[model samples]
Target: MSDRHIQFQTLSDLYDDVLPADEREAVRRHLQSCEACALEYRRLGDTLKLCREYAGLSLPLDGLNDRTMSKIRSARTRRLVLRSLPAMAASVLVIVGVGLFSTGTVFVRDRATVAGSRLSYSDSERVIDIIRKHNATISQVTGEYVEGTVPVSSFNDLKKSMGFRRVAYMMVDESMPDENVHWGDAIEEVGHDTGQPVRDWAPLTGTGASRQYVRFRVFR
Candidate 1:
């Protein structure tokens, strides 16, 4: 594949055993050939191992049952919301984000890409409302495409509240600031992610990593 179809969060889910059997197998096959993804998969495992060890040393934790049930409830809620949504609701959203930047342009550490049919005008308004509700900065709006920065703290709520499917991670050329490129411009060049839609974004937090570009092309 010209563009990597694996997402950071998707790999994390695989490591955590959260993906369905077929999906998990697909990622495994991809990892076998993609050296970078394979390396990342290993590193992610190491990091999670360390985190688990660290938490065991210091942090209190909820029981496994509580955690498991919480995920079950959350998944059920998303399913219910999606089923109840009208035709006017966004049927599919594909989020693809680029590299993490620290200073110039926008200080973004996360990216979201949506690839599907163009959104209807009414649906576009609702998408914009969610972006605004999360206090994301809107820099560009062209047809169904919206480009801007979303806060790290609120990204999950925004993603979950709306329901979503994520694509692979992408990094733009060094000459271009990630915040400046729209998904449309980039997708044509690097190609779109092939991975099936799945869950949440990669965890985003760090010094100078305050907001992520929630640039999308699914709304007006």
Candidate 2:
């Protein structure tokens, strides 16, 4: 019989015992000659043995099932939110485009609000109102923002201080503002400055926005 490399998927199916009899026999014969496939099969066997050991372990912990289920639910929810993000952004863009085309008015008034300009104060206040309004929809999936202040340093420090895995930070651009005046741009700057990645952003404080300090949250 000619020797051929058995595919990982074929091996997986063989382990799961879902292969037809002829294919199973063929794979069995291949495994007998292929030292590399034999080693991989042994590794899979060891992993299964470990899983069995883990399943049979009795740990002293209260509410273990509840905690495990809770984590599972949280993980599933996060996955759902992550999966939905692109659609949500597209929907928002479509809504804004329609509003702009129909009403002859900008959907987000703060879209043009620039940093360090005289109009920033009142304009940002209005913009923040718009942000809060949009935040209502975002909170449906990400949960409410845990509002708090953190000292400006690095992105890792900010995340560590807030106790969040994924987050987006926002603050009013007081001065020394980069060309990005929009909320998304400003938040991106924060991400760059702090060396952390962000997904969503919203206003933390209105009018009297600070430059040194920032308020942020972990929502999704």
Candidate 3:
């Protein structure tokens, strides 16, 4: 038997289906002529076939692709819902919180709670001064009021003066005399613009005010 006929490298390429058809035919001819190479090639082919058979036995082949794909899709759906849960809960909370407090008054103080406290008559005069010095126009109706587009300095002063850690701009419709109009819509608009929660409320008084205004009031 000849010590060399075809190299194992060529045989490997042929087995892997990487060899061109002509080269593959050439290797096949060499394998047919050489007994040693032919035996080795047959052994390699048998080993690969056995490995494939073993793999088929080890893995579940009944609806395997469908089941695996279904599991993957389910996992992705679960992850998507989990990601959206907080935003959903927060939206629900905002709706519920607004409904609960919409009819009642809210404090402009630093700490905002359902049962409002820390807002009293003693801070009313100081709060008004803070609003006035900031060049924020107030209603002559004895309630707190300010207009939008004021200077940032005045806004900060009002917040500090009111002892509130945060402040929100609420849009009021003067046309709605008895009740707040577009309150939720206003809250959404202001929240989107300022990225802050609307935590303050003031009465819309009948002072012959023709335009919408931002009002401030201390909740008792």
TM values, all candidates: 0.30, 0.28, 0.33
Error of 3 at 58 (Å): 4.9
Which 10 consecutive residues of model 2 have the lowest summed lDDT?
A: 136-145
For model 2, name the residue pairs that clash. Answer: 155-194
C-alpha root-mean-square deviation, each candidate: 26.4, 20.7, 19.1
Highest-scoring model, TM-score = 3
**Candidate 2 overall lDDT versus native:** 0.51
The ten-residue window of minimal lDDT in model 1 covers 94-103
Summarize candidate 3's per-residue lDDT along 22-65 as a digit string, tens digits. 88887888788899899888888898899999877765479989
Candidate 2 lDDT by residue in tens digits, 1-220: 2367788788888889999999999889988988999888888888888999999999899998999999999998887577447545744564454444345464554443412222233332332233333332121111123223333434344453332233556653323233533446445222223445444433343345345545454432
Better of 1 and 3 by lDDT: 1
- Alpha carbon lDDT of each predicted model: 0.52, 0.51, 0.50
- Estimate the lDDT of model 1: 0.52
Give the runs in model 1 whose Cα sits over 4 Å from its true position: 1-117, 165-200, 205-220
